[model samples]
Target: MSKIASLVPESLKSSKPSLIRVLNNKYGSDPEMVNLTVGEPDFKTADHVKLAAIKSILDDHTHYPHNWGTPGLRNAISQYLARHFDLHYDPEGEIFVTEGASGAISTIINGLCEPGDVVLVPCPAYTLYRINAELCNAQAVELETSAPDFKVTPQLLKEALDKYGDKVKVLVLNYPVNPTGVTYTPDELRALADLLKNYNVAILDDEIYADLLYEGEHLSMAKLLPDQTLYVNGVSKNAAMTGWRVGYICGPRDVLKALAKVHQAAISTNATMNMDAAQEALLHGDEDTAKMKAEYDRRRKFLMAAMDKIGFEYTKPKGAFYLWVKVPDGFDGDSMAYAEHLAEKAKVAVVPAAAFTKLPVRYFRISYAASMEKLQKAVDGLAKVFAQDQAD
Candidate 1:
């Protein structure tokens, strides 16, 4: 191997792929495997959104667009945020489009972080935050919030701030959080805001699953802490356009200006056609999201009931299509080993909790984004696994 290969940063060289992708790769080709390890929506992009992309193509919109994003798409996103979350952002200087929410997260972390800076990440996190922080030569302090219903509380924030002090540069907040599907109520968001209001840290609020809430309304931290929150969202989850790779970052003009420089250096601009499709999703795709969300709600309910019957312990998810379930009793609390056993014996796939955080956890995350029939098959396999463990 070349010296350049050895010179690659330890963060990138040593990091493992996400557990979701690893399981998908390992069992995706298995004829009998019931893979529920990915957080992707199982819905297709809305036809209208596709048509918008086609229209953009036909209009010869294939050339390079604005570096920030097409003005029309940014305006659409501005309106979407206002309509959905009661948050306002200036489309001209405050909104920027990136490759996807993943890319947006990378940009924000890279932009704001310096060597030795600390990022407060509430676990079980999306996993990417830790990797991103490491890549930026910063440290990720995981404030384990699994005991507080997986929702970050004011007390937790206070404890993290007190310990990390001024070294803390950002707080990565994602809700309808992945893995757990727990979201904060409006009042809860306000309390967090109150605690962080005096702090110097920026809040990178990732609300990519905002449109998929089933129980209560979704609230944006940007509304409460507009000056200090970098709101990240995209059409991947709600519009089922993951391949499109269109996402936006909106925030205070000064902060966005700095983020825009990083974004521009990263990807120059997102694809023109994808931005057109995203514009349609933002402006005219609420019903499309609602339709997909209803199906997800059904799947979530069925999965919750099945987990209960199988004697697995988990909190009922209210937003994202996932369950953070404890390892069934009678088995050693080793999520990776348990997940591999299920994959080999029962032909089911799940992500071990170790993939999300460094905490010694005995839980696995299940994504219910598959069809009802597929979900039923997975439940059947899990039921067998649970019974087999109990018997042994």
Candidate 2:
């Protein structure tokens, strides 16, 4: 037999490049480069939250935590969920705090999927879902939702269930979606709940951006489909605590028990200080989150107006800090090519829409998580590029 060069399977080798790295390579390293490619909040973590973590460290709370998580943090999560979503979870047996939403998702997939199981993922999805599914030896089946609204309709879900049958064991649901920023209404979620109730599928509900809703109250699938949903959330988006790497999952006791074993084997447990900080965030950081959400709402309006003036068609995102803009007329619809042209010719960097999916050229995603001044400058640069395209 030939010498073994690498243990990784061909599936992992074929995974796509990181979108942030691709944009950075195209835009070159300039301190002045205005980046709209990242989805992280521009705000810093609240002062009180940081202080709490520091206090924990100073008090000698640095020892390894319980394999699942501390009772205090899990209890905070349970209370937060019930208050916000009217969902009930027993903190002692139903919550598993992991490193972050990414970690929680990986643990869930690793536990639920056997080799060749299929996971239904909506296209233009966050990259981690597919990557983790493939890593778990499961198939990532992309269900395209290019209709007027970028949502998975009941009929579409039925079609997928028919095609994949029992092989499709998990459905990943991300509201205020990463690339599209589209959120589901309560009615839409209820419909999805009814349909999934009939199937043997479970949901990995990623609600990290739920608190960033600008138009209306956020709805959680766990509220409607608690028995079948493993809910994942964190303070990263709400309190700008991304660097802390703290998030948790809530579900049925049995489901969480299985996930905890996977989490223990993989991570042992999350950082002790970070969990302390996250507990403080969930209990006392609402005011700071509200302030950041207000700022994001303002930036969203400004970005929407800018896209309108630039003559670009886009779906107005009601939540999250992203705008999914369609490429302008007379331009080749290849988002990567257009994004590169804008980066090189217009000196602005935006993530290509295709990075979120394999689709015909039409749409691109622009993040408004930057300050207003940076957004205005990027729009001005894009205007120049569009004008030059018309001239050509």
Candidate 3:
């Protein structure tokens, strides 16, 4: 084997790069490219949040922070949880701040999953979860939920629990889910929570997009089953603070205490200034989030209308800024082929849905996180190429 290949783990060697990122790197630089492959909000961080970070730096809060995050930020996170999701997690020992939600996810996976353990990942999820699990030498079992609008139902939960039995260590749940933009109602969440209560698995509830809802209120799984759930969230999506790299996890004290070891060993404590910014965002940036979300709603409406005019079918997003568009018959349901043709002929980029699952699917994801102008240009590009496909 080559020296470069030998230096890395077998897992890293065999892993596939994220297709969403690959497409972004390919077309993101072009001035004419209307990139729609990433979920990052196309908005600036709020003034209050930015000012708090500057204040923290000036006040010499740059020294090593507490391993579980500063008390104030933890309290802010706790308050935000209670205010938004009706969940109460004690700041003293129930919350651990990390680099980002991605960091929190890796910390939780490493903290709880031993080698050869099983992790249940639903289809059309953020691909990072599967990558993180596989990198940990754990098996990621994909629960294919293509039939029921890309959601995991109680029957689906029971089947996986019965099959994996005791080997299952974690069940990841992402709502307003990435790529698909699907969320559950309270009754739907209750049914899944009830079925999960009988199992011996841990729940990694990723609710980073909870604040970006377009319609109904967001319901957290942690509220229904707090005992075994590690609630994950951050300011990245909500506050347009993606570059700040601040995220947090909340759960029972004992579990959080145990997980702190992984967080400390991996990345130490999160940057103190970033935590300060996140705290301000949580406490005072509701108007900031609301303004950005309102803009996203506008963009979503325009994009969906454009899809209608271009004859592209997709599930209407209720929360999160993504559209799970079907690979039209002109493309023969080949999502990758359609994405490629769109990129070349129309100068628009999208992510094929197959990357989110282990199996193939006839769908792709278009992030509506861009401006209305860009959405319009992307739709026009689609019309041109789609017209060509029909002509062919």
Candidate 4:
């Protein structure tokens, strides 16, 4: 008989392995390695949240969850947004939970996009957006936002809009952005919103790190353009509940209903126990997140000062736990090669900027999500590497 094998999905067949995971797997086993490569939070999920999950399981609430999530969760999310972002939605009609922010992005892109549509993604961004766009058969057009500060400027938006026009269906954005710790000011977002309002593109605002801001007030674009914004967030980053796999989508009724169908088809719903835990986190974990943020701020300042002393140029982080640093001159500017060399010589690991870019740029990101002790060690290791390179 002839050998037979299942065909892989075209998307998966060509997809490159996630560089973040690859680097972690390669360096994670080394005893002396200080792995600053991944963004996994060092904090444990709050005790009350863990207890809620346990209580749900003991109370026999482990059956299949509602596709739109539990009433309590949806209502809590509505209230959370209203209180923080000053944006209101009907929990019954506009909220839908998914496996994570990644799942929610998949649901929205696959649900909303048609073949040949363009999804505008800002470069040096979270790589999942580009991968998701490719999987959905839409063009993931990246506009590089590295020059003049790492932000999506109004002029850049206009240039892309003029070139792509109605073919653009969705604009994906993440602030307190991954890789680069830069975020937009409210006035900056409002200017982009003014141009966006004239176009028919919907906004996918991924605000998973909204609560981790170290400077400036966090603003939701949905507050400025609610009719066209699909707000995606979760307890993963804020409450250190990443393994819980609970995330959400809030938007206008019609579009949310469409996304719900995709959500149902993809995973039905996230686990009931996880949803219960997420509800508890959302309802009462502000203190837990606040404490974590304060510690992260301390680490952030320490890392920036250390980088300056070591002679690496870095953008001062505004929010989130990552520091974006430029490859110093006199070194070849291949971020992946530079990162690997650092890991080998200094026993410190950082993610290469190539992982997050759709353009050719030289940068790398160091995550401070580790403890202050670990961050200090990593910085010391990095300093040794820089000094060694200069000597060589």
Candidate 3: tens digits of C-alpha lDDT, residues 1-392: 77686689898888898888888898889888899988898899988788999999999999999999989999999998889889999999999899989999999998898889999998878888888888989999999896437889899889999988999999999988887888888899999998999888999999999998897777899998999999999999999998999999999899999999989998989889999999999999889989998998888888788889888888878889998888876576477877887788999988987678867878889998988888888888889887888888
Residue pairs with backbone overlap in model 4: none
In the range 1-392, model 2's lDDT, one tens digit per residue, is 44674776887777776776677575646656677888888899888999999999998999988877888898899888887778888988998898889888898888899889999998788888888888777998988887446889899889999999989989999998888888999989989988999998989999999998998667899988888999999888998989899989899998898889988988999988999999999999889989998999999988888878878888879888999888876886588888878777777888887787766647778888889989888989888888889889
Runs with alpha carbons beyond 4 Å of true place in candidate 1: none
Model 4, 1-392: lDDT tens digits are 33443465676667777788888999988889999988878999999999999999999998887889998899889888887778898999999998888888888888888878999998888888888788777899998886436889889988998899899999988898897888999999999999899989999999999999999988899899999999999888899988888899999999998889888987888888898899999889889999999999999999888998999998888998999998877787598888988888888999988899857778889999998888888888888889988998
- Model 2 poorest ten-residue lDDT run: 24-33
Model 2: residues with Cα > 4 Å off, grouped in runs: 1-4, 25-28
TM-scores vs. true structure, each candidate: 0.98, 0.96, 0.97, 0.97
lDDT values, one for every candidate? 0.89, 0.86, 0.89, 0.88
Q: What's the C-alpha lDDT at position 164 in model 4?
A: 90
Score candidate 3 by TM-score against the native: 0.97
Q: Clash totals for all models, in order?
A: 0, 0, 0, 0
TM-score for candidate 2 = 0.96
Question: Which 10 consecutive residues of model 4 have the lowest summed lDDT?
Answer: 1-10
The alpha-carbon lDDT assigned to residue 15 of candidate 4 equals 76
Task: Please give the lDDT score at residue 75 for candidate 2.
Answer: 88
